[model samples]
Target: MNKIDYKSPIGLIEIEGSAEAVRSILFVERDEIVNTIHHETPEVLVDCLNQLDEYFRGERHVFTFPYHFEGTDFQQTVWNALTTIPYAETGSYKDIAVSIKNEKAVRAVGTANGKNKLSIVIPCHRIIGANGKLTGYAGGLWRKEWLLQHERTFNK
Candidate 1:
């Protein structure tokens, strides 16, 4: 797998993937940044970085690059549902459960959401508490708030 670190507006982002498809994109601390020399970066990783740049600049709302998700079927289902949420919009765990035709799986939906490896691209940050409050985000609530605010600003 190939990996690269990008300094994003929020923090450092680590993107991992192969030439075929992007495997994961997650936030990392400064210390977590890997030190490795790549002879040549893959085209896909470079493309993802450009798209991310566009996203942070508020010039792009959707990601069109190729990506791969590795998780259980339930997790994949939840991730797929997350993508359906329009840019700058939010959804609740209960809402996702109902969308998947499993209204009783609200808690399960939350669990699956936390397991999401791909961050902004998969849009796990868009999920919120049913009460309309910001909830748990693997990337931290502050970053989630920043992302929401960022999108809201650009959505206009």
Candidate 2:
């Protein structure tokens, strides 16, 4: 997969994918070693970068780029439900589990959320704890809060 780096409000983010589909958008920790660099931006990546720029600027609410999700069926279902969460809105793990028609799978929903690799595009940051507290995020809780606040700015 091709990879490009963008400096975001939270930190440097690595967007990885192919010419046809975006694979992952990850937050890169400060001082993290990056061994791969593809300076050339394919059309798809350029589009992804543009959308991310719009998102950070509070000018966009939805993503239109194609993304490739490689995961188990349950994980993909969870990720799909994550996308259904509107911008600036949040859902609980239990909410997601129930939406998927497996209300007893709340913990499994959280686990699947942790496995989402698409970051902002997949909108896993929109998932919160049942108590309405911010919860586990692959990008870190701080980044998750930042993303939620970022969307809130536009939603209101």
Candidate 3:
């Protein structure tokens, strides 16, 4: 799989995948050294970076590049529901569970949301707590808050 690191406003994002599809887009610590041998950047990865740039610049609201998620059926369902969240809106785990027709799976929905590897593209950050508070985010809650505020700034 090909890989590239993007210096996003929130932090460093490691984009990984093959020429055909993106596998993951995760935030990495600045000091962490990625051991992959450097190779030519795939066109798909380039497109993803470009779109990310547009997003951070407040010029893009949706991601159009191809991306793939590796997870269980339930996790995929939760991730798909996350995509349905509007660009500048927020939803709760219960909201996701309801959208997936598994309203009682709120906790499970939160678990699956944390498993989402495709970050902003899949929009796991949009999921807040049931009480309307920021909650768990693999990339850190600060980044989540930043992302939400960033989207609101652009969406207005």
lDDT of 1 by residue, 1-156 (tens): 899887788998999999998899999878555734366778898899889999999999999999999999999999999999999999999989999999999999999999988899999888889899999998899999999999999996
TM-score of candidate 2 against the unseen true structure: 0.92
Output the better candidate (1/3) by TM-score: 1
Better of 1 and 2 by TM-score: 1
Off by over 4 Å in 2: 31-40
For residues 1-156, what per-residue lDDT tens digits would candidate 2 score against the true structure?
788777788888888888899998888886453634446667787788889988899988999999999899999999998899999999999999989999999999989999888889898899988898998898889899989888888885
What's model 3's lDDT at 137?
A: 95
Candidate 3 — worst ten consecutive residues by lDDT sum? 31-40
Alpha carbon lDDT of residue 3, candidate 3?
Answer: 84
Q: Per-residue lDDT tens digits of candidate 3, residues 54-143?
A: 999999999999999899999998999999999999999999999899999999998999899999999999989888899999999999
- For residue 67, give model 2's deviation from the true position in Å: 0.5
**Number of clashes in every candidate structure?**
0, 0, 0
Best by TM-score: 1
Model 3 CA lDDT for position 145: 98
**Model 1 weakest 10-residue run by lDDT:** 31-40
RMSD of 2: 2.1
